[model samples]
Target chain A: MIISVASGKGGTGKTTVATNLAFSIGADVRIMDCDVEEPNAHLFLKPEIEEKSIVFTPVPEIDEEKCTFCKKCAEICRFRAIAVMDQIVLTFPELCHSCGGCVAVCPEDAISEIGRELGIMEKGRVNGIDFAHGKLRIGEAMSPPLIRKVRSSVESDKGQLGEKNVGKINIIDAPPGTSCPVIAAMKGTDFVLMVTEPTPFGLHDLKLAVEAVKLLGIPAGLVINRADIGDDTVKEYARKEKLPVLMEIPFDRKIAEVYSKGELIVEKMPEWKDKFRDLYRQINEIGSVKSASHKEK
Target chain B: MKIAVTSKGPDLESQLDPRFGRAAYIIIVDPETLEFEAIDNSENVNAFKGAGIQAATAVSDKGASVLLTGFCGPNAFKVLDAGKIKVVNDAKGTIKDAVRSFNDGKLSFSDGANVEGHWT
Candidate 1:
């Protein structure tokens, strides 16, 4: 089962929930840190990376020798990346969408594609759980390519998604937002564990996240971190939205202290291991419910 | 001379003015007499992928041997090179200033004129 842990607001303990829960399971698991912009899961898990691969995207290259200056390639381009004149062609690489429409329209086949490296995908093993993460190059505008690369790595380890029972649970540490990056991280998950605080900002962004999850039609549960710091607004929103609040991690100075020192919570509070295990079971039940509903539809 | 200018808005008259995604307009001014006709590429129907190819085609179509413009990325530079159009970067002040700069042979292209992402 794949569970995506996401938060609408930053600093809502998504990484904590993801890493500790995977560790507590103590089974063959997989964890993916999809926050390519600023990945932080490695700090806590300390997994020894065993493999790495570069990610790239294809951009169009126009050949003026055969282009005939017809401007056919430019005319078909939707991103305004290609243009042609009497006999000359101008191209703007930055504005290019990497779509092959320009190449397809070039009557003379003047356009070819070249790959541009955008980021790296790293694979590691923490305990028995296989971990993968994405590291995007600085100044790279897009993150979805790298996130997709990381997800592809997970698939290479198993047979077709449902054909083989890898018998491992997957915990996806998603980026904080309801934007394209977050969606790329959370898609294809069996269930979503939304981590949020009990504050007004948390409630507001949580609503947006809820809207997104509903649009995707994925089952979701809430994990309210720092439960004592803010008011009851998040709980009220959760109740109204009909989303269940699964785990309530109280605001404790020691947990913050251990977290700041790069320590995992399960390692410190041995008794909470069962609580996390129960949380995973509850999450699995939610996934089964979603699967049944999807079959019905 | 007839020249094509790359603009976001649709019209030849908007070449002297700038707007978002407008980048630079192609104005085919006569090198000897400084008189010209301009093709305003505001419809940008052909500018599907990036501004680079659009600018190259506009310049080439206008029978322009020289391209006077602001900053450009590498992909567009390759198209310009393929078309054999001379490119001058960092042309500021006004369209007249840019034309004069081009005529005076004062425009130059640095190695990094075409960087990644948008001008912003």
Candidate 2:
């Protein structure tokens, strides 16, 4: 089962929940951090990555030898990264979106594709939990490709046929947004655990996130962190939306102080283990109900 | 010559695309005469492939003579280079003014690539 842990607000203990949850589940479990821009799961897990690989994206390369300045390639490129004039084709690599439409429309066949490295991915094991994450190169604006690369690495490690790890669970630390990166992280997951604080900003972003999950047709539950500090807006919204309040972790300085010291909450507080385990059970039950309802209909 | 200025539109309409890929359009203006207009690009088939490629494909379709814009990455450059297009980086001011600068040979093409995240 693939369970994606996501939050609409930043610094809301989303990573904390995801990492601790992975440790609680133990064997046959993995934590894939898909937030390529700023991955902090490693700060807590500190997994000694066993394997590493570079991620690349294909972009067009032009050959200026053909000599016909018809400018058809430029006419076809929507990104404006390519411009043809007076038999000269100018390229702006930074502006390219790599859609390959230029190569497809090039009348002179001068366009070719080349790969550009975006970032690196690490695959390893932490406390028996298989780990995979993408570290986007500093200053990289695009995170989807790196996210995709990490996802591909997960499938590859699951085995060549993708059937060997059919029953394993992958808990993903998704980015904090409703953009393409977040969507990419949550796409194929069987369950989504959205962590949010009880504040107004948290509620606002949570609504957007809920909409995204609903649009993706995925089962989701709410984990309200710092439940007591803020008002009951999230609870009110969740109740109105009929979203399950799976678990609530009260706002405590100990949790915050421990987090600052780079300590996993599950390791520090043995009592919370069972809570995460119960959350997992509830998620499984929700999945079963969904499938059962699908079959009945 | 039927010069095309790199606009934000796709195909003939790419001249109107609000932004080229992630960045603004590459103002495809006449370098010799400084006449500026947006260029029309083509449809990006692999819109899901990646944003860089999508932008490159979009701009290259418009038959732009020169890519005059600020901010872009290697992926976009590869597409422009593949089509034998030259890039003029760090271009500022109005699109027309940039074109005039290019026509007057005041816009010197920079060889160095813009490091990602350096844009103001």
| Top of the candidates by DockQ | 1
Error of 1 at A191 (Å): 1.6
lDDT of 1 at B104: 79
Which candidate comes out best when scored by lDDT?
A: 1
Docking class of 2: incorrect
What digit string (tens of lDDT, one per residue) describes model 1 on residues A22-74?
99997778889999999999999999999988888788887767778776776
Instruction: Please provide, for model 2 over A2-46, each residue's C-alpha lDDT reduced to its tens digit, 9 standing for 90 to 100.
Output: 889999888787898999899888889978999988998999999
Candidate 1 structure lDDT: 0.75
lDDT score for residue A263 of model 1: 88
**Tens digits of per-residue lDDT for model 1 on B1-120?**
432333422333343333212453456677567676655556543343455555565566567766656656666666667766666655565566556665677867544445553433
